[model samples]
Target: MLPMEEKFIYTDEEKERSEQILTELQDTLGQSFLENDLPKLRNHLSRSIAANAIRRNVFGLNPILCALQTAAIAVKDIGLKRDSVLAILLHQSVQDGNLTLEEIDSRFGEGVSKIIHGLIRIRMLYQKTPVIESENFRNLLLSFAEDMRVILIMIADRVNLMRQIRDVENKEAQRSVSEEASYLYAPLAHKLGLYQLKSELEDLSLKYLEHDAYYLIKDKLNATKAARDAYISSFITPVSEHLKAAGLKFHIKGRTKSIHSIWQKMKKQKCGFEGIYDLFAIRIILDSPADKEKMQCWQAYSIVTDMYQPNPKRLRDWLSVPKSNGYECLHITVLGPDKKWVEVQIRTERMDEIAEHGLAAHWRYKGVKAEGGMDDWLASIRAALEAGDNLEVMDQFKSDLYEKEIYVFTPKGDLLKFPKGVTVLDFAYHIHSKIGNQCVGGKINGKNVSFRTELHSGDTVEILTSTTQKPKQEWLNICKSSRAKAKIRLALKETQVKDGLYAKELLERRFKNKKIDIEEATMGHLLRKMGFKEVSEFYKQIAEEKLDPNYIIEEYQKVYNHDHNLNQPKEAESAENFEFENPSTEFLKKNDDVLVIDQNLKGLDFSLAKCCHPIYGDPVFGFVTVSGGIKIHRCDCPNAPEMRKRFGYRIVKARWSGKGTSQYAITLRVIGNDDIGIVSNISNIISKDEKIVMRSINIDSHDGLFSGNLVVLLDDNSKLNMLIKKLRTVKGVKEVVRI
Candidate 1:
């Protein structure tokens, strides 16, 4: 359930959109590619779109276009390679089950597959959760520290998503996506020195979260355009003239601050829009040699400082020691015309590109050198991350106070890295494919432990394997790394294929023993009649023992006699048996229905969504599902906003009908002090109400607080409220909420 996936509505629209993106991809190539590579590139794009043919992402946008746009940013704005672009494009195809990593490796290369592997490794972090857990976030940082390109591609992808979400009707999704953008993507962009993208992400996030505040600042800035432009011209003209006269090759440009930054300033300073001064900054990008870049920047800084009074505290010089991401700049705030403050940034073209494109541009510069390449930087990061067992000792990464990963040493003293919460089974798989297939258990730090035993960093690990032991389906959940999971999947698939061959041999023997003539037509009819689409599936079922050998032989005999005149099987359309009559004013008026689901969707039936049960007299909306049924979800349902944003065309306004006469099951979460008999007290209140059926109650006490889920059957929202009020009156019951 990453956004823009699932619930595929139309195939033709996807094809049309894919064709458009393919053109854009060709355009993106232009003259930067070899003529001989065009056919291969076309073949790759064709295969990619074919795999992701029916999928959409980012509020009902084509996922292929989503990737194409991100690749465009990575190439045009971030200066990434074709490999990075291919990773971004084909990663979704692999994730959506349409393609495989092995296929990518065979068709493209191991390099592209590696980057896609990194992308999928950390794909779970983008779920629609209120807050990312501390441990998960740290693991994410570890993943980012492993591959800086993943961070850049993800930032680019998020930027593409933020720009497209404005037309989405789901405000809740917008707010959540906007908030995550503000919290994670913006900071990562800033840290990577993608200042322009960082500011744009911040502004878009503000537009989604605080609509009024964003527009208010935007309006103020718009209203003061004349005066602001005059002042900027006055400041830049003088600076430009002085720089030119001083024999410096440079150009100066001034612009207003981002609306988000201005709004933030207004809040932090506790002032109105006009109260914030220094609302803009002027950038001086110098065209200088790679060697004279610093000297020229200082010379330009001197010319500006001499004209305006420089504030000592506002001076920042990073020319001597560039940021880790290779951002080099000199910043200063000075008193300008009319005693107003103005911020100034001075850097060379190379420095500016590094600041604009972040690590990718830095990589471009360092690609010419021999030492401290991207691989070396990542190796150093991995070493630092794995160097500590106690994160408290590491003074840096306060937000990630404790690195939630563990590093263990092999018996030969070789070091390996693993995220925290992984077990010895994962370690075995990381060692070798054969070892994982035969892994039984392991001894950690000279202490024998089960395959499920969690290992800590700095501990020596020894893996135990038996040739007879084989992988089981349950082992899939035991391993955490993508490589281990993929190996297990491959091993299981190989076993299944072997088992299928064995089953086929058994079937042929049975047919020969029964003296029955075997024909391909007979097998096809028998397979279809037995509810299997593929002949391999029929054999696979027999291997798994879901299909009986005797049953298959009997069915084949029956099909051979009757299936000759039968046409090939065609899928049946499921027509729902129900009615949605016009809403009565009596039922409708009681709810004050703004959303009246008056018409029955042509052939689809509707049901209340179980995630958020829509009780009688509750506000609701209809969502068309892939199952050809409409799910009625509460207006306030957590997933409602996402549904609206993604499939707005399929959304139907709904209201509860008064004709309903049913007791809906709702789960209520009750929290209070862990007093004696608190659970008993709550249960008694539910039991006392003869109208309300007390379904079940599960209680847990933690840190002197009582928290429990109380499942109860109620008639409607009114009764739900009454029961909640009664529960609140109980001793030690502090809060009650329907979930």
Candidate 2:
């Protein structure tokens, strides 16, 4: 700890305020904690402030002061443990303060330092946007799972920052902060079961995001507070008396809903402020022992129903099996005076704390138990992070975080929760990857169903598996879960590896039989010439029969013959030495860049004929046109025979002596059945090939049939053929041909 003179220069009033906050924090942590390390902790706090002041100008209150206040709030308000509180106080220092990680570790223990490190890394990850933002957010959740304390501190820190956001002067900064709080942090808080923090964050964010609407809702809520309180008093009076008569010790309070929630209700229901119902809720806090908690909750439910007619569908019983986030309560909407619906929540004091403080309260009161506790929730998050790092995994993480969950049961009566719209295959993968890979079908509720059948709440599903069953490439399009897709990809890659090895062995045997003695270096050059990036890719293409073995042998022979001729004597060559069947083809000239006509057509310009769009490797001849310029045409051009008969003397021999290094514009015609996502699927395949550039695509569909035209820029004919082969594999595509 630093000396007293080096401490933060706080005014007398600020010092008093800090002391008061520290005292409250110590009191909440209890006297036993104060006796052990409170003094040392307090010294560390002062030294942190001093270190921060030296490196940066202390703001009006300074982040250190704000952090301490937030830590105190976490303890007294959120019921977090000592480790979490310490993490909150020091989290900012890890990134912004003069203190380093080693210094923090020396001051505090390793556990606190580790949590701080994780928090800093998560914050850094959050700074990335758009491309990898979702991936980073999923990583943030995984970090939270590694240590629940990190998220607890983050929630506390966000709550404090939101409360103080009004002091920020920049409007754009305020908007950015408010949007992040509303879209990311508030939903996270709600998912963690911290209703109080969630509501506060939402309300604060709304105040900044929609200034006019927030003020209107705020004014209306304030105006109706008096009348609403009277109505609540009159409504609960009879129920209170009945509970008293039944000898049930409980506390009933009128809880006014937050302004943001009321506004959300108005918008969602398409109603005005006056038309909104359930603006306030009544919470019944019962005092019951641990053994009688569930029984007492149901008993209270029965009593409430006796006093008023309850809407059966509006009832939710979480006491029997608390929510995955450790929320336990019984909620019911009862018809009250003037046919108004009054929402009532019944829970014990312990349940109330957990509901308000969320995971922090769970850790504080229940400890870290493995079953249906915080540990279990953490394990699920960890499993999701371990699944894979891809767009599919990010989608799964977001679905798990934000989507409504449905609870189902197994044949053994064990309850399981999955995101809504999950299918039987997702369930199988959730059980085990091997089970999912080998799953042939499933029986939902004792009736056979397809693997794509969507699961619903309370459905018991049993996956049928076969030993010979294997995952198909089409399964990637059917499964919705990230784990299933990842496992399938891994299995397919392994199979490809094995097939590639066998193809390589076959190729080597063929080479040995031919006495070619093809070495690895020679093979590398051959594969590169064929536009293959890897030897395995070349072998895989061979094994898939996409490349013909005869073509490979011919190409290898060409290379061998070229090398053999290079060792022999050189031969004189000239354009006039070439022989042709027709005497008129005698004066042909060769050009490295473009075709050159004979001296007879010397002054004539030459251009490729568009009729055939002849490329470098095609057999070609030149024609003297009416404009007196030589025009090149492929031997197979549709007009070649007519031109040959019409003007035989005008034809001139032409050949390309060097390779063309330019992209050629080409058009392809695709016909297929109209299907969803087919265009996007085709686009994905095209964009994935680095050598292929798609210039434009047009599609027309009618009566279940679709025809598409694609204009692309490509290097050579081989790439065009490879692209056509890939496009044929897209679902619903029937035929692909180049026009």
Candidate 3:
């Protein structure tokens, strides 16, 4: 027996509206789409829209209906593919309806499911928390790394949202939305080559964020609309006639500047609307083949400039080298009717399509197999994501995203693009992480420059490297790219890990000499006795030679003795019980104020010379003195020459045999502008480097300038140089010279 099958039924109105929408989609997508995929797509969309009709009041509109409309716009208006349209339609399915990714995969395909998954992730990021807007935007870009179609859907969705923002009633919500759209979404659209969408987003955002100013400009524009149109007609009539006589197929159209753009100009120039020149642009779109676009565009530029005097500085030739986002157009400003400045844009029909629809049109006009223009951009986004999450990383990511790009050349004549204000160190890292780590400096156009040199366009750069050079922590402040900073941090962490392991081994060997087993408990006890919070901290101190291993061994020995003889009577130790025998009378007379050396070198005593104040890690020698047993002097000290001349044989070869725990004083002189925060800023910079300790500071401010001397305690020359480099990066610091 056959079971009766149930069929889903649609109401008369639902069927009529669904047919209408499908017909519209057919008209926009052409007959091939209707014959191929429209029936199944229509069935799914109809059910999805019906299910979502109950919760369609977020902005007092049906979200599913709006989504379908947006998808159709993406397909017909923006020339997107069938998968893109389907993804757009179901982007919110999981969040809004009973549909799941599994069901979508079964109905549509894996491609649609993947795009929908990316879109859902982005939506979840938005809905989670209002943390850092820049971080959220960065994550959004990172999401695009998985599927670029996600960004296209997001742009289309934003366009639809901006179109319907006027229906929302809450002023505060509207303002918030507008500000985000202006600052974040508009910039993204611009970066993606969606010129029309960017303009609309910017204009709508300005209308909501600055309502009063927007209306004032809008009213003024309306008041001058008739006059501006007449002027445009008069200005273009002569150019139109010339192009016609030249047998060129072209259509010239007038474009009014967006309100946001005009507002920005007014604020920058501090002028009223009337003072703003070139309020509109005339676009001349030529009908030419893809191969002839560049030639025809330039030919049209010649015709337009022949009618008016062109501003030399205002001429932009983008036809030769398109923008990074794939926008191709030639622009020029000229003195037009009534001596007013008028801007003109010349491009072929293919170029016009790209400018209008952005990458969407690029894919369609260039065919599906053509190279995707966003691979490099996606790579950068993925790099940032792999760098990890933090406020500093977010700031670097934003800087890379929004800053203007500059083009430079390698020694091999290959062109490379980097963000403006990028230093040579950043360029090195862009080539490879290893190269950046070992970079000493570089040569720009055959002249040597520091690694901190800001690169400019068209400069030939050659990175100089040395096998011994390594990345210093201070390089983080010098390199502008996020990738460089991330790599530097990783390298430093790996080095520290290795050093920590070596320190642990050294401590273990010392413990073994005392006949004590080195275990976790023993290590913990030692860390507490040494005032360290963790074993790793104790190990790091040992590795840096900041803490003496002998001191650690003595502490553990005391514990060992106490545990073995808790009940024994305490006995006062006499001077005779000391390990070192009393120095001979001759030794006492020779050593007046010299401190006692370690037990291993019991017969010797020495004091660091005041002339050099030699610290740990310095190349030093011991000098036998009449009153002092031995005086330690740096190898390059000023007194070394005089001493050698006076008593050459008195000098004996000496090196630091044990850890030096005492601090050594060093002086630094700084000169800079006498700003209010100059002193505090310098202090802050010095404080941030953990290895250096400030002893004292003396400053004199006069005539809007300041000179200061700082006495700081440092272990070695490396720490001193690092501190000096950090001080030089301060805002008012002009010079940081070692005194």
Candidate 4:
């Protein structure tokens, strides 16, 4: 650790700020905080904070330091120790290099060091693979990490950064940071139950990503707040009065959903703001507890639905189990007096607390004694850590974090949450570590489930684990849960290590049988030839069946092949036989980098240009570009038949296997009489298909006629044709044409 003499001393202004923070920190720590520890705590916190800035090359630590100090103060209020506070202050410092691990270990306890290390690991572990970035993948992996505070701290840090990102000098840098803060950090904050922080991050992020949209929404919201309040008050009057007359006790509050959320809903549903169904949601915070809450909410749901006609499909009952994020509420979408759809959420005070505080707050309120089965999840993570290597555990962590989870139940009504599309192997692992290891099969709701069977919500899963059954290495590829994958890998690695020793012994025995004494020199040469510098690497490969012992014998035998029956070498005889000498080794070496335009390339069929949707998985032919590359076009591609007729010689046979995941943008032109809800009708038809994603819409209406073009993502021509047919079925008496 840096000594007091070497540590940075705060300026007068900074000292004052630090002192103010110290006061609050002491309050939070209370009797646990030692007065004598103040100087050392200051040094650690300062070094960590300073190190983070310097390492990220974010120089001149005026505001950032102030922000860090403020954040430290805020986190201390949560009752963290001096080390935890210091770590929080300097969380990013290691990556920045303001302080080293040695300093951290010496200054802070191992627990603090571990937390810092976990943070570092999370940063490094994520995004190492290209596939982990998918939002679904990320959420799946996070669920298994079992460290809520790590994620929470990171989120807090991001939130703090976003609040002060504009103070960053560089324009490009500011935009980049803002975009990330909006896209990732904001949504994460919302999901984590940090409502205030989530909204701020989201609004700030939107300010950068869609400044015009953000301001437009903000302006409209500000202008309408009073009017909106009046409308809500008018709407709620009858419900409140009726409930009072009915002698039912309830509380009502008005809420407008976040602007960002509204914007996303509009974009997703392909509708304008006016068309959104549930902009304003009425939340009823009930005065009840655990058992009575769900029953009371259901009774209330019945009462509300009786008074207001509800969209049966729109009713969501999460009060019974709550979301994985700890959000619990009963939501109902009902037609109000004016026939407009309005959403209502009902929840108890305890549920509301969990919704806001999530797992951490729950732990604070009830400790581990709260019998919710979350302990099993925590145990799974600890088990995964103990049984797996760093990389293996990291993979499991990511899978759990990013996956959409399914909440199932056992026969006895115990709740079980599995990652969406989880297999029986995951269920086995969830039951117990050993069961997962020895799981051979499973029965879901008394039906024999295949090993690859995807589990659904409400399934009662029973694992069939055998003592003889072991984790298959192939399971690593198929397992969805990080815990299962990690444990499997750990088991495989241990088995491999054991097998490697056996292979080493076997190799030594073979050498002895052949009278070939394996010395360090011989082993080194063999190892180097195989691209391994260590004997252990060779043994491991041998154990893995990657290297053949017979190959070694052949290599040794080849040495004598050069000096065959003649006194001269074999090369002398070859030279005598051949009048023409072979070229030098350098001349014989092929330059593979040279792009070869083969005569067979003409017959090699079409090469799809991914830039334009060539649809290689459809009937295709080549269009030779002037830039010297063949561009494949689908037979029905607007340009294809024309290109084929013009350049017949370039066109080659292409066939479709009919499998594709990539989306192709297809333009559809619709002509119809102008009418209200024409766009809505068209959108309903397009969206109902489920397979199509509308990329953009251009509507042109003039002289009582409506004509527009929609750019939609489709899988193939069939889907495009189907969409066109569907659009024609709309009641405007319009013609749908593909453009």
Off by over 4 Å in 4: 1-22, 44-81, 91-102, 126-132, 135-147, 167-169, 182-191, 229-238, 285-330, 334-341, 346-739
lDDT of 4 by residue, 274-311 (tens): 77788778987777655677787787777778888998
Q: Show the colliding residue pairs in model 2.
A: none
Using Cα atoms with residue i matched to residue i, what is each candidate's TM-score against the true structure?
Answer: 0.43, 0.45, 0.45, 0.43
Taking the candidates one at a time, how many backbone clashes does each contain?
2, 0, 1, 24
Tens-digit per-residue lDDT, 482-599, candidate 2: 7778888887888788889889888888877877787556666565445455677678767876555666876676556655574355575432221111111111223224554664
lDDT (C-alpha) at residue 104 in model 4 = 70
Residue-level lDDT for 444 in candidate 3: 93
Candidate 2's displacement at residue 129, Å, is 3.4
Enumerate residue pairs that collide in model 3: 590-627
Instruction: List the global CA lDDT of all models.
Output: 0.71, 0.68, 0.68, 0.60
- Comparing candidate 1 with candidate 3, which one achieves the higher TM-score? 3
Candidate 1 ranges beyond 4 A from true positions? 1-18, 30-53, 125-139, 142-147, 224-230, 243-253, 283-332, 345-739
Question: What is the C-alpha lDDT profile of model 3 across 445-533, one tens digit per residue?
Answer: 78999999999755678899999887888999998878889988987788778889999889888877777785565556545433355
